[model samples]
Target chain A: MFAATMAAVLVTMILALGRAVLGPTTYDRILGVNMAGTKTVLLIAVLGFLTGRPDFLDLALIYVFLNFIGTLAVLKFIEHGDLARNAGDGE
Target chain B: MLEMTDLVDLALLLFLAVLAITIAKQRNLFVVVIVMGFYSLVSAALFTVLDAVDVAFTEAAVGAGISTVIMLATLLMVGTEEKTPSQPRILPLLAVVVTGAFLVFGTLDMPHYGDPQAPIHQHVAPRYIEVSGDEIGVPNIVTSVLASYRGYDTLGETVVIFTAGVAVLMLMGQALRFRQRDGDA
Candidate 1:
């Protein structure tokens, strides 16, 4: 059942990639990337079960943190073209 | 149970192939990166099927998570679209296809999936599993391996993260310098 679900997720990822490539805007690509990230988190959990290794989950947790921070940084850089932009601007 | 696992593994293999092909054909860099993340996710699933949870976690985090953000950051610095007008070079892609096919063929001699008697179950894994419960006391074998047997590798991973953080800081500093120079002009 998990494998089947994972296959479905793979199909969804392919569609997301297509949308990203065809997307007319930056936001669309970002959205696609975000979807991929969400799917990956689920993938990690399932993998831990399949492999009989729960330790992988810890790494997955850290990965989640990294993903969130990385995505925010990317978005900020996109808007301001630099991470150093004054935070006070609220733009 | 046997039939079910086999069916699922086959399906995953097919999906992985399709995703890889789609990713390669996609013209937009952002789309390519997104598809690559999907590929990583699928590969992680495969790793799970193969009973390598530690690798799967790393794949999920680094391959899918960090890579996507890095790709997007790079896209912002450059342009999102592929360099205009040039069709994708087919020869290199063909080479990739051939290499991948060879790899699959090379696996023909390997044990069938989920064979309990396979070398994987016989070798180092058993000791790790046995001692893990008494020595390390971590029910999660994957964690034991990462923190105990492979602590050095984990330290290396931490260093990589530190390097990435420093790189980001440097990038921000350069951007500040550029802005200041423009203002003075």
Candidate 2:
């Protein structure tokens, strides 16, 4: 059962990679990467159960937190063109 | 007998290969960064399957998380579109193929996955596994190895991360100062 679920996650990840590669717009690539990040968290959690090491869930949680920060940083940088720019500054 | 786990591993490896090829072919810096994030994610997954949970955790945090953010920050400094290479691709391609072939040849000597008698499994790993429970009393052998046995290395890693964070802050501060000077003028 875990194997099947892992296989499904792998499929989604592949599709996401494909989208990221073929992106006509930066947003499409960002979205694809974000989706892949979410899938990775799921994959890590499932892998924990598969391997009977429940402690691996901690890694998944870390991934989730990092993924959120990374996505936000990318989007913010794209919008502002400078990471050091003030958040409230109007373009 | 190849188990279900092995089969899943094979599938993941195939996906990683495909992702690598796509990333190599991509020209957009933004898309490359995103694809690299996916590559890190898949690598973390692969590490987990290899039963290296601690390595997997570090890979996800550093590779997928911190590195992705750093790359994006870099992208902000350098424009998104990748410049076409001025030099011919043939020399680089040959170099890459030769390096790849050498790596494959190196792998030929590696022990099969999960082989108990492998050199790595024979030496320090056995002692760590045997003594960690009684000596360190940590349930997670990885924690024991990284924290107690290899404390200096872990401390060094922490110091490196701290230095990087400080460097980034200093650079950002400089940029902000320049902006303020412009505003004052």
- Best candidate according to TM-score: 2
Candidate 1's residue-wise lDDT over A1-91, tens digit each?
6657655765675666556455667678667656655655665566556545655676557656755765676577567766556878676
Question: How does each model score on lDDT?
Answer: 0.71, 0.83
Tell me how far the alpha carbon of residue A25 in candidate 2 is from the true structure, in angstroms, after superposition: 2.5
**Lowest lDDT 10-mer window, candidate 1 chain B?**
B1-10
Q: Each candidate's chain A: what TM-score?
A: 0.78, 0.90
What is the lDDT for B11 in model 2? 70
By lDDT, the best candidate is: 2
lDDT for each residue of candidate 1 in B142-170, tens digit (9 for 90 to 100): 88998988999999999999999999999
Could you tell me the interface RMSD of model 1?
4.0
